[model samples]
Target chain A: MAVTKPITRFTLFGGVVVLLLCLSVFPSSGQAPKNKDLVHVEAYASHKRVNSGKSFHIIITANIKQGFHINSHKPLDEFLLPTVLRFNETKGIAFGSVCYPKPKQVLFPFSPNHLSVYDGKISIFAEGKVSRNISSGDINVSGIFTYQACNDQMCFMPESVGFDIPLKIVKAD
Target chain B: MVAVGGFLIGIILFAQVANHVHKIFDPLQIKNLVSVKQLFSAKIPEGVPVKLPDLIITTIEGEQLVLKELTSRNRLVVVNFWASWCSPCVEEMPHFEKINRDYQNKNVTFLGIATKDLLSVVRKFIVQKEITYKIAMDDQDKIANAFGGVKVLPTTIFIDNNNRIVKIHKGYLSQRELDENLKDLLH
Candidate 1:
């Protein structure tokens, strides 16, 4: 038994090295908190007139995973943070007000007691008026979105998301 | 004596291992420590008085309360916007309650407004938390909009005697922050 002491120490050292190596090799996947949870955005036009001076619509949607809900554009309590969407206006392009979808009420253990939020998916619609004199072709619209996602346990810090949508413009009738 | 020494060493090792495991599992503690450090080190914006939009809300007792009325008593009004489902709001309630009690006679008034929430829930939360400060329900979120549209839970607006907005704090404020704000306002 006395002769085996050095061998045991070597085994312990080897085990620690293997554990460290495994930890270093397997980097964590930077997935959003919930599995299969992600936010998606899309753009559409009421009329396909993709012409200069034509009005187009952009709808940004966030699809939450099952059993999870995102904070509402307007939370129930004044102290609860409200979700905000930011847009950068481009030359010759005019952006309209953002229309937020209605949120559902939720209950939790925290104070003033209940909150309002959107579960599964929600959409924000905005109208963009194209420039009247632009040469017909592909037009790019872009903006940044800043919002905070929260669960029953905690609220994540606000995250900024940038998106660009391309549209085909032609002559308006 | 040797056995006792060995037992103590084993306990020490067990404690160390347990602590390491706990640290790995508890990310909330790390987040909280970072927030605490930010609270202590961040530059606190200076309190400035600005006129706020007028708002009226209904109290739990079914009385109409106007924002302007709070300014009549030459009091420093602390308006805390909170909901029952916000953890930071819950954590900070006791501190506000304490401040309300400690400065009751010091011309300081604390008003808690529940925005975008049901009145019943706000009433229950107030009762459960043993909050003695005046609490009102902003059914339409009008009050919140008047306060520059709060972007976070536990956002507190400090109003001076003249009903001017003196400070706007966003996020879960520590007792220390509240104490300092109160000290500046009270004096």
Candidate 2:
């Protein structure tokens, strides 16, 4: 019985060590990437218009990969950061306020609170007007879009993306 | 039997140690993806003197109340816009309740406005959380629009005695943040 006891103890200890090794090698779902999931940003205009006196609207859309949601322009709470859009202005081209689409409500696991966010795709409308004094040429508008992405378990660091769009200015009379 | 007992003891000890490790590391796992400063730094545009729409809501006590009347007094009004569905808003309720109690004797009134939610839900939430403060229901979101389209839940607007909006705080507030803002308004 004394010999059996030592063997049993050794076996139990070995089993525990092996279990821990397996856990370290393969982490559980909770330890998986909460926000490393890829998010795609795409910009599209409803209609291509030559720069004219009339105002033209360009839509910028962000399409998040499945199983992820980006914080909206306005987050429900302080802990959840808001997405920001910076517009680089040109000398003769003027841009209006960037309008954001309404976001869907999401519930996080760690937090019982529901947050407003944009999952899948969100469209932001940017309207620009060409000045009458502007000559016919290609006008470039560039800006950095910043936002934080999160899932149920954790939130990822905020990412800033830069994009530029060129529009050909044409005289309309 | 002694070996089994020792193994059991080891297992228990391991579990206890793991639990402690988890507790210590759980908050560290929280990546401050976006710093709290970013949220607080969002510039609240100057308060424009636009005519605010009148909001009539039923309080948790079933009292029908008007929003403008609540602002008639020279009290520091903390109007919090939230919904029962919001997690951070619910998590911060107890803190808000404590703030209300702390400032009860002072010249301050903390009002919670339930926006984008049904009255039944708000009632159940108030009862479940044992919220003692007066919660006004903004049906049809008219009250939310009146307050410049709350845009997000858990948005708090601090108004001074003169009915001018002194500061706007967007998001869940810790007890300290609430106390600090209230102190500024009171003083």
Candidate 3:
């Protein structure tokens, strides 16, 4: 009888350890969705090669998850935060005026008023100028994209998504 | 050895209880507990009872209408600041018109003031929306600035017969909330 009691206790402890390990390895489905999963961002250059001192459009396309919409650069309301894209200044590349597409007017229940929003897929364009003295090589331009996403019911916290667009620069004759 | 086994079992049991408790409370529900008023209160001024500011705006017909002049009519006036691009403003227009219809003989008037929109677009929107209330164009945003600046679209200001700003509502208003706020104006 004494031997049986010890064996049962040892088996119970082993079962608990195995259960904990399994739980840790496989997270439950009830967990909140990660911020990155809500939107997909891709940055690309309009032209692969451009002469130095010439300007080219760098386009950033954002694919927002279904049922979610992001605010436009000009939200038209003071309370709403606008989506902004800013590029880091590189030695060989200079970013110029950033242009945002016209946003659709969406009336959401969560917002007390109408909001200018972009949903599904939207493209933002920025003009990039290669330095007049730059050599012929591929230059990588990195930028940060910030936006606030919301649905009809509620809005998620603002998130910043980083992107890198590669461009080739040719020497200006 | 026995003490270590007991401690491990206690920790495992506690974790199980914690996990179950977390599952019972939906995180989204917890987040929704924060009211919209609390979220916007940081920027939206509180609705304090004060005299409505004197302002004038041009109607779509190019006639000037002064807000203070409407005070002597011995009626409740509902002033709504909106733009054609604002979706919430469009959605609430019919509701306002409906309420206006209900109290047409109660000495209550509903006025819609369009801001930041071209008169052509405002006229087009009014025709499309079938809005019959008094529509005014605030091209210069003068009327909006006088009423403490319209930071949000679809801001409705309720004025009593005395031209006192009784309630200032910010955001998209539901039928129930509109009715509740208009209780004073109605009866």
lDDT of 2 by residue, A42-115 (tens): 66545455656767777777878777678788887644457877778777878899898888887765365577
Fnat for the candidates in order: 0.06, 0.06, 0.00
Recovered share of real interface contacts in candidate 2: 0.06
Question: lDDT: which candidate is best?
Answer: 3
Global CA lDDT computed for model 3: 0.73
- DockQ ranking, best first: 3, 1, 2
Q: lDDT tens string, model 2, B21-90?
A: 4532333112211354532243333232233446576766788766567666647778888776555577
Model 2 residue A66 CA deviation (Å) reads 12
Report the lDDT tens digits of candidate 1 across residue range A43-141. Answer: 444544477887888878777656556668888665455666666777667889989888888775443566777777677888888888877777667
Instruction: Pull out the clashing pairs in model 3.
Output: A112-B171, A112-B172
* Interface RMSD, one decimal, each candidate: 10.7, 12.8, 10.7
lDDT of 2: 0.68
Model 1 gets an lDDT of: 0.67
Off by over 4 Å in 3: A1-173, B1-49
| DockQ for all models | 0.04, 0.03, 0.05
TM-score of the A-chain for all models: 0.70, 0.75, 0.77
Model 2: colliding residue pairs:
A77-B171, A78-B171, A78-B172, A113-B87, A114-B86, A114-B87
Weakest lDDT window of 10 consecutive positions for candidate 2 chain A: A27-36
Tens-place lDDT digits, model 3, residues B85-150: 555666677888888898788777788998767787787778877999889987776787777666
| TM per prediction | 0.45, 0.43, 0.51
